[model samples]
Target: MNTLPIRPEIPWLAPLAGYSDLPFRMLCRAHGAGVTNTEMVSAKGLCYFNRGTSSLLNTHPEDAPLVVQLFGADPDSYHQAMDKTLEMGFRFFDLNAGCPVRKVTKSGSGSRLLENPDRLYAIAEIMVNKAGPGAVGVKTRLGWEKGVDTFLDVAKRLEDIGVAWLTLHPRYGKQLFSGQADWSRLAEVKQAVSIPIVGSGDLYTAEAGVRCLRETGIDAVMFARGAMFDPAIFERFHALMRGEESPPRDGEHLARIVRMHIQYTREFDGSDRSFRKLRSFIPRYAKGLRDIRSLRNELISCETWEALESAASRIREMQPADPLGFDPADVIPD
Candidate 1:
């Protein structure tokens, strides 16, 4: 069987909704993310050529080896979407069977796919057959609810279908981001599957990323909320992996990266849509600033990029403060 075409020991950036844009992906890549997946695309949207869906397919030369994640239950829709993605030069694909949103699950997709194992297996089989071996993988959760070991069976099915790799986030569908992620579940799945397993869920710090790899013995680790708050995480984690001292993340570094992210967004889409798209990110970049609450309100309401830049400039000049009540154990939303 073909294996995942990514490096081991390098942390991955998870495909987050409304956050894993090209600009953010580029930053993480530069910061040492071994691989990055695009935000999940609707298979039906791509089959119909929806304008919004088309925008998600955008890529740059620097973002090579990108994994395009698709969500839907229909085999035909997946086939069509895969065709379009391959034509656009995306070589890696991930089927999202873990999304817990009601709107998605209500349609017999996302985590709901877990309720119907045969159908889920069929989807993986179809994706592998259609996209070709080694080009497709899957990202899924433990099961539809707590206390169910459905994932163990599903993982084996996916391996039987020839999936390149399996990225398991050890949370039940109903669990959402509530409660703790069962790392033991990850270890269980790892033992069950022969293919490479990428462990995810609740990994929000460079230290956690390191520990997960060592404890779970999975092939790789993926960061979602952690990367959003600190794109430099991969770089720092990479340094630690190599037994080297991590570079500093002082005020100047944060300011420079914030500026760069804004510039990249502007270049990607020169419109208010992109401007609004960046509003939520400001707080992430300004996470540890003095009085971040006030700074967040100011940035979230900016109407123009210039205004946004002005807000960012003020944040850069402000004195950096230690994180407010920061807990290394807290898992931020993805």
Candidate 2:
């Protein structure tokens, strides 16, 4: 069987909703992410050529080891979408069966798929058949609810269907990242399946990712919220894997990250909407930093690229006391 372009040491970037765009993926890749995924695309949307769906397929030549994630309730449309992506040169695919948003679940996709284990397995089989063996993966939660954990059964079935790998978020659909990500469940899934398992959830730092691998014995980890808060988490993860000290995340270093992301955003998209989104995103990078709240307030009013660049400069020069605690990942409507 063909193995994924990932290992226990090389981390995968999660298919972040509204965030993991081509430019963002490229930025994370530059920092050391081994694999990156496109945000989840609706199969029906792609089949019908929805307005923004095509943009999600945008890629750069350097965006290798990339996976395109798809979500939908219709099997035929899902197959068609997968075929479309495969013909367009994408080699790896992931099913988004873990999103808890009502928008996704109401359509019988996302975590709703978890409630139908048999159907989930059947759809995964179709993915494997369409994408080819060792080229398709499934990403799902532990179950639809806390006490109804079905991941063990689901993982076994997916592996039997020849899925290249499995990425588990280790939380139920309704749990919605409310509590801790049970790393113990990851260990259970790893021992239950012969195929590779990539653990997700609650991995907010390089230390957390490394600790997950050591404790769970899983094949690898995929960083979602962690990467959003700190794209350099991948580089730090690599350092820890090599038994070397991770780079310092001083204010200037973080300022550099802010600058690079801004440059990449301008290079890829300099639209007003893009800048607005960046305004919101940059504050996440400042997570745990003192005197950053006021900077965040200032960013909210930055309407021009020049203005945003100037604010980033201030971020570099100002000496904040220290980083405060990271606010947990917010629950956004997906």
Per-residue lDDT over 132-222 for candidate 1, one digit per residue giving the tens place of the 0 to 100 score: 8788888999999987769999999899898989999899898888888888888898898898888888887787888888888888888
Off by over 4 Å in 2: 1-3, 329-334
Best by lDDT: 2
209-308 per-residue lDDT for model 2 (tens digits): 9999999899999998888988999999999999999897777988989999998889988777778888888877876667887899889888789988
Q: Name the weakest run of 10 consecutive residues (lDDT summed) in model 1.
A: 323-332
Superpose all Cα atoms of candidate 1 onto the true structure and report the RMSD in Å to 1 decimal: 2.3
All predictions: root-mean-square deviation over Cα? 2.3, 1.9
Clashing pairs in 2: 288-323, 288-324
lDDT of 2 at 123: 78
Model 1 CA lDDT for position 205:
76
The estimated TM-scores of all candidates read 0.93, 0.95
